[model samples]
Target chain A: DTAVSQTPKYLVTQMGNDKSIKCEQNLGHDTMYWYKQDSKKFLKIMFSYNNKELIINETVPNRFSPKSPDKAHLNLHINSLELGDSAVYFCASSLKTDTQYFGPGTRLTVL
Target chain B: AQSVTQPDIHITVSEGASLELRCNYSYGATPYLFWYVQSPGQGLQLLLKYFSGDTLVQGIKGFEAEFKRSQSSFNLRKPSVHWSDAAEYFCAVVMTTDSWGKLQFGAGTQVVVTP
Candidate 1:
């Protein structure tokens, strides 16, 4: 069984289009997180949710939003995506503040 | 501001040769350090971590790291290299705040292995 999984491994959309990436974890972890890896391969934390409660919100733009309906799922929705929003987004889950298990990652490209 | 730094952008080595990947961290508080490896088209896997106790930490695949508090460095080293070990190595530090699983990763270092 996959510990963490993300949908739409590859995403290609036009600029200004709205899209959402879904993430789920089966590791029974209470904390889930979202990270964005840019073209330079610098993986930075975007947001984190503990037990479906927002905890960490980085200096990301307002167009990016994270939704967690439950502890097992954390989704990222981007409104009015721009060309600069192209990057690889990875989802991860962990047992509190510990070593995290990461998903395969979702590659998004805005043209 | 907590951050992780991997100075080596790329490193190549021959099979059976020794390998060392440098990792430096800057954190105000006691830092939880980690080393992760990512194969092509795969998710990141934890190789090892340094929370406390001994400075030298052993990880899977014959990998080990030594955390030097004086230098603020956690460097990953292996006695020998294998072709399968060619991957991107990331150095990360866990945040001390209430937020969970927020890892500040360095710009990864790409390793290539030759026969």
Candidate 2:
């Protein structure tokens, strides 16, 4: 069984469109995170949620928002997607103290 | 601010040869260090992590990392690398600050193992 899973492995959208990526973890972890990997392969933390509560919010634009319905699910929604948003988005989960487990990642292409 | 630095952007090694990837970090206090590997079109996988206790930490896929406080370094090493090991490796550090498990990652290093 996959510990972490993401829906729509690949997403292609036009500029100014709205899109959402869903992530689920079966490891029963309490903390979930969203990370963006740029074209240069630099990974940066975008947001983090613990027990359905938003805990960390980086300097991301207001267009991007993350929602956690429960401890097992965290979804990312992008509004008016721009060309710069073209990159791979990764979903990960971890317990209060341990290494994070990652999903298969969703490659987002904004044209 | 905690930061990770991977000086070598790319490294090539022959199959069955020993391999080493250097990672350096800058932080005010002892930080939690980690090494992760990412295959093409895949999410990053945790290789090893150093929290406390023994500096040497062993991980899956025959990978291991050593944490040196004086040098502020956490270097990953493998006795013999297989061709399948060719991938992009990332070094990361987590600060003790109560920011809800924030991790600072390095630029990453691409490893190419040839037969």
Candidate 3:
């Protein structure tokens, strides 16, 4: 069984289109996060949720939103997807400790 | 603000040779540090982490990292290299807040192992 899994490993959408990526973790972790890896391979944290509460919201554009319905799932929704948003989106979960388990990233390609 | 720096953008090593990847961080207090590896087309995997206690921590896949408080560095080292070990490695630091775990990552370093 996959500890952390993301659906639609690859997403290709046109500009101005809205898309959502789903992430689920079975490790019973209390915290989940969304990270974006740009073309330069720089990973940046966009959002972090602990037990369905928004904990950290980095300097990300308002177009990117993260929703955690529960402790086990965290989904990312992107509105008005632009060319600059073409990158790999990774979902990760961790307990109170700093060890994070990452899901297989979803490579998003916005045309 | 907490930040991580991986000075070596790329490193190449011969098979069976020793390897080392340097990671430096800037933070007000002692911060939690981590090292992760990402294979081609795969997500990042935690190699090891340093919270407190011993400075040296061992991880899976024959990887180990040493945390140096004096230098504010956490460097990963391996005794020997395998071709399968060629991948992108990242160093990260946790934000110094009481909130849940949130990580700030470095740019990452690409490792190329040659036979």
- Candidate 1, residues B36-79, lDDT tens digits: the string is 99998788999999889999999999999999989999999999
Lowest lDDT block of 10, candidate 2 chain B: B95-104
- TM-score for chain A in each prediction: 0.99, 0.98, 0.98
> TM-score for every candidate vs. truth?
0.96, 0.98, 0.97
User: Can you tell me which runs of candidate 1 are displaced by over 4 Å?
Assistant: B97-101
> Which parts of model 2 are misplaced by more than 4 Å?
none
What's model 3's lDDT at B35? 95
Every model: iRMSD: 1.4, 1.4, 1.2
Computed on C-alphas against the true complex, the DockQ of each candidate is 0.77, 0.74, 0.81
Candidate 2 on A15-43: residue-level lDDT in tens?
99999999999999999999999999999
In the range B1-115, model 2's lDDT, one tens digit per residue, is 5678999999999999999999999989877889999998888899989989999999989999999999999999999999999999999988876557788899999999999
In model 3, what is the error at residue B41, expressed in angstroms? Answer: 0.6
Tell me the lDDT of model 3 at A70.
94
Question: With candidate 1 superimposed using the best TM-score fit, by how many Å does residue B114's alpha carbon deviate from the native?
Answer: 1.3
Error of 3 at B33 (Å): 0.7
Could you give candidate 3's per-residue lDDT for residues A16-111 as a string of tens digits? 999999999999999898999999999988999988999889999999989999999999999999999999999999986558899999999998
